[model samples]
Target: MVGRQITWISSWKPQRRTTTSNGRTPRYSHWVRYNTFYGLVFTTTLATLLLMADLIEWRATGYLFVLANRFPGTVALIVQLLAAFFGLIHVAVVCRLINYALRLRLRKASVTLDVLRTWVDMSIPRIDWDLPLRFFFPVLLVVFLSLVPAALWAGSITPFIDRTTTTGMLLLPSYEDVSLIREYPMEIGTSGPSLRTQKGFFTYSVGVQHVGNLLSSAASASSSTTGKRLVHPKLDNTQFSYIGRSYGVGAPAGLTDMSISSNSQVAGYIYQEEGYLCNVTCIYNRTSAFRLRGPVAEWIYEASGNLPDSVDSGEMSAYIGHTGDAIVAIGVAHSERSPRRYLALAAGPSYAFLNSTQCALDFTPHLFNVTVDIANLNISVVPANPIPDFNPQRNLTRTVMRQFELLSNDLTNLYVSLLGDALNASIAAYNMSRPPNAGRDPVSVSEEAATLAGLTNSITAMADDMLAAYASAQLMVGKTFTQKRDVQVYLYGLQFGQRVYIYAIFVFNLLVLGAVAGEAVRTRGWRELGRFNYLDPRDLVIAASRGGEGVAWAADGLARRHSKKKKGAGEKRKSMKHVWLLSDPDEGNGSLSIRMKGDGEGHVGIVVRSPLFPPSPDPEKGERGGGGGGGFEDGGDAVDADKRAAQREWDRRRRQKQRVGLFGSM
Candidate 1:
């Protein structure tokens, strides 16, 4: 009841008049609106800042980048503050827009004084729950947009949590730097080593294999991390792209198996990788049992005494390359075997053995594509090439194991040839001396193997993948001979997806802010927006004071007394309208009021007459006493006097409150 007092001009503090820069208040401010420009400025500023934050990614090299990295939490707080500021700007834009709308509605329509009231002052959290359905649409949207700043804060800050992937070029150990790998020691057994591949065979600066990783990939093509022969963490959170042929060169120094290779240190994620690894295809041949024995480059004698190298076999092995081929070689082997599904013939059980129809290899260099999980150290590798006989899909194998390839034309190096030859010899030796393929797949041994192989060969599951990734990790961990190359090092920062989401949110914010600002200028309402202050209840009270006698039935608690009948939906509520907030003008200087249809021109409203009631005599002017408000239901000579008194009390209370400066206490 205290805040509900009706207002009159008598209570409002008279605004002191002031001259405008144009020397006079213009119609639509002399055909130009100034506050419209102010609104534009606010929106533009918000847009620029939002865009700036988005563009500054991991690659931002200076102060901002460092600040975001070193004080991530602090930076995040600052971002939140900025978002709050953005909200403030948006609020101002919305307020201005509502005023312009009110002005338009005032010019074109007439209505009951429902007091559109701060767009129902809808921005408040709990003051009025009925706001949305309580007003006209689209116009309400301006008020609804008060939520924009908050929405932007939630939707835009996506990169803050993506700390594992700030991508930028860095100087790290590359393929050319291979000192990182554990060096193989001097070995003399069946280890791979051609005549030209002994100690000090090739001059390598950092101590061993020079080139590592990929072969013949296009310069612009992203590196493939799907090779079956790459060894790395299963849950990698980092990534990098190689620069040129900077990977290491040569085969692994007798390293065997994936366990000996790859690490899970905080180094980085190896998402995609390219390199060369060794693969072998074995074709099974059936044969009769007979005694045979020998090594590569020799003949195995059979039980019959005379037999060709291919036909005679308990076990046998042979090599195809002579000294002319210094780095690469081909070989074959034979072993007695028991088929998985054995068959018995009428001529006695026939035995199967890999004989003359076979070629021998522990492994050979072939192009390989790899995918690695840098975090968990799980590595997946696949041979990109197809085989002549083995059907991978036809095998019905669901599990994909690490696989490698045989030598391809892209590899022109002979430095690590010793390892290849060793692998070949080891396989041959296993064939001729070993009884059958039933034993675990054979692996070549080398004591010089300082590091275990990182990538695994699925066929034998016996040795490491001495391909590209092994060399890379070796070099990176060793941190030696690292020439600064523009390696695309992925660390911690925003990712592609986060950036996209932010972009979309920014666009939405821009469009809404821009429309509100643009429309204000277009309609020329900005000039008069400052004249109205709808947020203050004082303005509404003054408007109520001006309501004509037709609305007197609701005055002095009359509506409350008759409140039993409730109206809802289209049946309830109506429109009302504003008084000029004249703070900018002096007391003597007059101000304008955009009166509503229900308002009367004079301070005291004229009475309304309805046929339902006999008209009462007007209050005796000379007997007009201190205002006491409306008379009771009893019809009497005092009825008009009571009404005049009630109206006067309402006016006096409103006038008292109005005298206070609206910009200050109000």
Candidate 2:
């Protein structure tokens, strides 16, 4: 191949013999073809540029002008529309041709005299012009039909974004409404080590347990008592990425605060100490902790509404467990007819962490008020107690429970507002201000910015009104924010018609392209069938795994059965095998747990294993196992079961990693 390539190169080189002391002369035909092709390319390119500029100007000003004033009449409109259509078609044809020629050149031979000569000879002056005619004719027909009065039917059209906007939600009336309602529930993946799974959920992250080691002296008098050995689950020594790690109070006593540092996904935290809650503020990233060293403390006093027995002009001091501790202070409002009763929750090492937790807590609560009865409070605790070694276990429980109750109520109310009528009203009001427009319209940046600014101002004003309503409610119920509300506002406004037009265009283009492709396939037969042969090579492994026999039984979907047969002598009739099926057991108390290596380094799973396994001969093996493996009296070794569980975890992690890697590459 190298020799052939060398020979080819030698032959292809321009000959010096034909150009003795002078450059070779250009052929007239070559010059003519090159000029003609480039002239066409240049003209098409100029037309495309002009069309784009015109469209943009039209969108900006909501007015179309081609060389000054051209009034809106069917004739002038039709001509302009036709020109735009043909111009777009011209671009498509040129682009496709360029792509095809480049591919051909790269895959076949380089530029050659024979190839150039053939292109010139075979080229038809009007052949590339077919696309313009095709695009223009259909557009012209549509325009003419549209102008007919009969075509203007009065059909109600659903707004475009309605498809993306989830339904059955009540919109929040205001920011204070957000505080009153709960945010909707979003599926959150959990993380951590030493977490156990039961009924499909992993329950732990940085699991905290108080350990007391007591040394007993030799007994003298009556009878001697030996201390029983205490045991606690070992923490998993795995630290996944911040996106996977779950943060909790490392220590419950001292200045126990949990915050996300700057370098990590966690931003900051505010936590409780062992004594009277101290509210100190600080800024932090990942590595270092900076005290709210700001001359002014970042602390806000929350009113407990009780005058201390020792009164030294005490304001509503936040119960910070100890001095110099940072915690999130959130107001919780419950409703009878109107949302009234309020409670404040404080627990954090930094504001950011507190805010995020507050947001997470608020999600479910905010949504509930919007959709259901505000009086109904359902709390699902993520059972991770703060570091219990420093603080008395009893005090820790009370503080944690109080914090959870207050936070849960706030979160629920926030979620309810987001999903309730308030959101719907907001969307409706937003859409009403601006309707969509189709017909190859153009947009202007300055005009759009002005419109957006006006909308933003209006939304701000509305939000303030909402806050006032909440404040009034708070006062009536006897409570308020200690450091006035500094609420962050977000506003969304979308043009309905334009979005619809774009969506319709996309769907129409897809259908038309598919039809064009089908027609092209029919016209060309199967000559280019090799183009679709590409595959990932990973999918094959997935398929094989699914196809394998003796796949792990999950007691869901397809069921497996054992076959039994009777052996007989040659003279006797042969007995056929009968399949014995084990029906999937009903949902029972028995559980199945699954843990993955990279997935928060913890376990997550559902329980479906049955309690019907017969007792094993080895009693030690039967009761020595844990969870699902121990539910049945199987004589399986504990280590072996653990190994199997670990392997399953590894598989799950591998699959998750593969998915993430694939998406990243995309």
Candidate 3:
């Protein structure tokens, strides 16, 4: 039976093939003729431009470069590790896609070869062995170019982000409890002026009058002294009296009351100590007859009151007789024997009358009785005449009279000389008891009085000075004090290596993120397989066809069988029918045989020559003539060949259709 045959001729021409000077097309395309140079240049330029842009952005931000420069070794190590990790993933993806593409191309070539063998029974004449290199190198170049940004990002920018973020987090405002110490000296003393003396005197007089009158007179006296007094008095006899106590006698009647003058200013008194003094005076408003008890001598002597003329209750007058001639009187009289004694005595009644008085005055009467032996003169005066029944008044007047006599002797030369020695001794003792340059001890009233007593021959000056000094000291001792307070201060703001570690971590994380992003962009969301799919199918097919022996044989058969051939010369070229080749290699050399099938069978068969396999032995050649063209003639063999070819063709057609459908969907 005759089988129908269908021939397939390639409509696609190989553009890379070129004819040589021998007028024959070369088996393989020239390597340099492919337009890979432009692709290589374009890809390289694109990569370089992208790298430059990345560098520009890095320079504009400046942080990455700065950090890298600051810690180059550290940054370089970290960047290398990061690049390695990303490069591994990139290489794995690229390799996987390239491998998959290679397998797919091989499978496609296998299917095409199966189709040609089953339908046409032919193979190509030659294979382009360098095809795989052309396809693979371009893919490798593109993949390599895509990885540049990822590597750059990993090396730069990441560390800066980490460092800045960590530093910010660590830099916060905080506080701590603290204590502080400080030292200083405080001056504790009186705030105002230095203390001074307030001096005055008092007097009392008793006459032949009612005791009630005396009490009333005392009650009428002023509470404090009113007149000015001396600050520092000299020890002299003409200015002060220290001789005897005297009383008025042989006066008018009706003076029946005892008068008292407390704190009266005494005139003609010499002050021999510092601070204030009080002298008492009693006035005889009415005369009363009085008598002297001892040493009665009638003599007129000037009596000067310590008060001013305007405030004095009475004028200076002469006293008649005096008694109680104490030894102090002889000393004063001896010291007053100078030529100017009378002149001083004449004018001493009015001195320092009223300079101005401070209202805040304190009055204290300090009385001291001091006695010292003098080698000047011996006084043995016995009272010549004495009045027995004339008792003196024992009131304020009597006390003033006695004090006046004592103070008078205090100013004597002998007393002054002795008092000076005593004051020098006291001062020397006080100085020896204290450190040099130390301040004086606070002087109390009693202390001041003692100090004055050591210097004065009378107790009044001692008492006054003691009272004033004591009051002043009290005001000075506790003038001010010290206390403690709290204060705020700043310590440290940041410490330790916290800043270094925080910045390092922050920059590291940021760099990693940048690396991921760059990688994603470069690989188009990590779709490496999809990216590799952009390789040309023709290139892949040629590579597959070149690499496999089965595909190479199929290509060779197709080239040889499909080429046009010239007929013998001089004979009219008979009309030639297009021939198709098919084969069944499973039948060994017999499988290489072909048979014709009728039109009713819907297939054609042709025997093709193969350099790889020997021709099959023909049954018709044995019947007709042996050792001739070996062609198959049995209907059974034809039937078997046709059946096998039809089965393989069907499978090839199905596979081709599936491949076409898949391509269409894509």
Task: Pick the lDDT winner.
Answer: 1
Strongest candidate by TM-score: 1
* TM-score of every prediction relative to native: 0.46, 0.16, 0.19
For all candidates, the clash counts are 89, 79, 56
lDDT per residue for candidate 2 within 1-666, as digits (tens), equals: 101111111122322213222222221233432232343343334334434433342221112222213343543455445434533443333333333342223222222212222222222111211122323243344334333211111000111111111112111112222232222122244321122222111211111111010000000100111232111111111111111111121111011011112111121222211111211111112321111221133332232321111123222333222332343333322112222222222333332232211111110111110011111211111222223233222222222222322322222221131111222233334333443441234652333333233323222222222222222222222223111211111111111223333333334334434543564466342121111000212422332232221112322111111111112243453332211123332221111111101011111111121121111122333433223332221223447666456435534543342211100111
List the candidates ranked by lDDT, beginning with the highest. Answer: 1, 3, 2
lDDT of 3 at 65: 42
**Model 1 lDDT on a 0 to 1 scale:** 0.32
Superposed model 3: Cα runs more than 4 Å off? 1-74, 94-149, 152-552, 559-666
lDDT of each: 0.32, 0.24, 0.26
Model 1, span 570-630: residue lDDT tens: 3553331222232221111011112332211112211221211122223433332222213
Worst 10 residues of 2 by lDDT: 213-222
- CA deviation > 4 Å runs, candidate 2: 1-87, 90-492, 496-499, 525-666
